[model samples]
Target: MQNIENKVAYITGGSKGIGFGIAKILVENGLKVAISGRNLDDLQEAQAVLGEDNLLVFQSDVINFEDEVNSVKRVIERFGKLDVVIANAGVGKFAPVDEISLDDWNAMIATNLTGVFHTLKASVEELKKSKGYYISIASLAGTNFFAGGAGYNASKFGVVGFTQAAMLDLRKHDIKCTTIMPGSVTSNFADHVPSDSDAWKIQPSDLGEMVIHLLQMNANVLPSKIEVRPSKTS
Candidate 1:
């Protein structure tokens, strides 16, 4: 396993759900992390849960390019170096194609697609210096489309294509890129209430473990893309 001790990770939407889980694992392995989110209260609560001194919280909306740039700068300024970036902030809303409002579609594109671009744009230079890894949290919808998910599918599909192109662009510098597409994760994404309906879904921690495994892979090889789904889905 590659040693991540003393490494610094910048994670968007790290206040809860998948981002928070990944942050916990990285911190446990001796990495210093800066977790960013739109809500300061939630970010602070997450920082408290992760404990003080190891995790730093930054409140910024990933959709804003300037904010993204400043947040990356802040992370490097505070931590001295940045090794990994996880673009995990996203939103999902279900609606029929004809019923989907333009605002909803735009929101999905802004947060899920453009947000990743802004994040990478903000951190690519630092990543190039450290030959770091960039992980984009896409979804199975990127490949497998379904009803009432038109906007989300479009954003995720764009993410899949974007990450692959970025991998090719970054590989020459020894920088790695990975797009993780998970299916039916049990979380409060886009206002979905957690219930027994989510019993068979994958947990946030499972994705965190996947991240650890990917980061631990030999530097000589890059997996590039990983598709994760529940073993028992109806």
Candidate 2:
């Protein structure tokens, strides 16, 4: 396994849910992690849970390119170098195409699709310097369409395509890009509070473990895309 000690990682949407889960694992394994979210309170709460050492919390909204640029600057300023980035910020709006409001559709596209691009654009230079890894958290909805999922599906599909092309572009630089498509994760996504009933679904930490696994693989080996789900249906 590759030695991850003292490396730095920046995760967007890192204040909670899957992002927080990944941040926690990375910190435990001796990485310095900087997590960004739009909510200062959520970021603070995460800092408290994860503790101060090896963690930095910043407030950032992924939809804004300027915010992402500032976030990368802050991470580099704090940790010296950025070796990994996880674009985990996203939103979901479930409704029929005809019924989905223009505002909701725009929000999904901006946050879920364009936001990923902004993160990559802002950090690509630093990632190139580190020859790092970029991982985006997509969804199974990217490949399988379902009723009332028009907006979410479109955004996630775009993410899958975007990440694949990015992988091709970055590999020559020794940078790895991967998109993780998960099914039914037990997260506070879509405003659903996690509960015991969610035990059967994939947990945030499971994805965290996967991230570690990817990071530890041999330098020449790359799993460009991964689709993960619970072992049993919930």
Candidate 3:
């Protein structure tokens, strides 16, 4: 297992949900973590909980490539180097293909698909320097289509495809890329409040542990694509 102590990681959408979970775990395991989100209040709140010693918070929107570039620069400035990048920022909108509004579809595609590209593009050079790891939080919807999930499905499917191709491209440089496709995570995705009713779903912390496991793997081993679901369905 590779030692992750003192390595630096930048997680998009790290203010809450899966990103926050990953940031928390990475910090506990002795990593310097930078978390970015568009919401300053939420970012500050997360910094308070995660503490100032190992955490840096930035207000960034993934839809803008410039924002991502600046974020990577800031991470490097604060932590010196970035060894991990998690493209976990995403938004979901569910509607029938015919009924989905242009605004909603564009929002999903821009934030979920294009956003991943921007994040990776902005950080690839630093990752090459560190021979690091990049992980994107995709979704089971990428592979499974549902009645009202046209927009969401398209975006996640793009994420899965993009990350897989990126994995192939980055491996020769000794950089590892993986897309984690999760099902029914208990998060505030799509404005749904997490509650006891979500007990059967996968938890954000569960995914966090998965990230740590991947980071600890031998350099020669790479689980390029992973599909994770809850053991029991609600």
Candidate 4:
């Protein structure tokens, strides 16, 4: 297992859900965490819950390339280095292929696919410098197709593909890249709010633990792509 103590991590969409869960765990494990979102209020709320120690908040929108780049710089300036990045911010727009509006499709592409790309492009240099890790939070939809999932599926599929290729490109530099594709996660993603009814679904903290496991794994091994799901479904 690699020593993650004192390493710095940047997590997009860390205000809530899986990203927040990951940040919570990383902080507990002695890594400095910087979480970014577009809303200052949400970031502040997260700060209250996650505590102030080893935490930095950046109000960044990953869809904007410059925003992502500046965020990288800001975090580096505050923490002096960046060792891990989790591209966990994503949006979903579900509709039949024919009924999917252009705006919805574009929004999914921008926030889910292009945003990951921008996050990576902005942070890759720092990762290379630190010989760090890059993790993209994709979805099982990247490989599965269903009615009314056109836009979401396309964006997630793109993320999985992009992250895999990035793993190949980055391994030579000793920067690990991975994509985590989850199924039926209980979170406030899209129209779903997690509740007792979603107990059968994977929990946010479970996903966070997965990232922790990856970080603790031997550096010679990489679970480049991982698919996680609920143990049982009703």
If scored against the real structure, what TM-score would every candidate get? 0.96, 0.99, 0.99, 0.98
Ranking 1 against 4 by TM-score, winner? 4
Between candidates 2 and 4, name the one with more favorable lDDT: 2
Candidate 1 lDDT at 222 equals 88
Model 1 bad stretches (over 4 Å)? 195-197
With a 3 Å backbone cut-off (N, CA, C), the pairs that clash in candidate 3 are none
| Candidate 2 lDDT, 1-234, residue by residue in tens | 788889899999999999999999898888999999999999999999999988989999999999999999999888899999999999998999899999999999999999999999999999999999999999999999999999999999999999999999999999999999999898899999999999999988989889999999999899988999899996
Candidate 3 lDDT, 176-210, residue by residue in tens: 99999999899888888889999999999899899
Clashing pairs in 4: none
Query: What's the number of clashes in each of the models?
Result: 0, 0, 0, 0
TM-score between model 3 and native: 0.99
Task: Sort all candidates by TM-score, best to worst.
Answer: 2, 3, 4, 1
User: Each model's C-alpha lDDT?
Assistant: 0.92, 0.94, 0.95, 0.93
Per-residue accuracy of model 1 over 141-213 as CA lDDT, tens digit each: 9999999999999999999999999999999988999999998898878877778878899988888888888
Query: What is candidate 2's CA lDDT for residue 226?
Result: 96
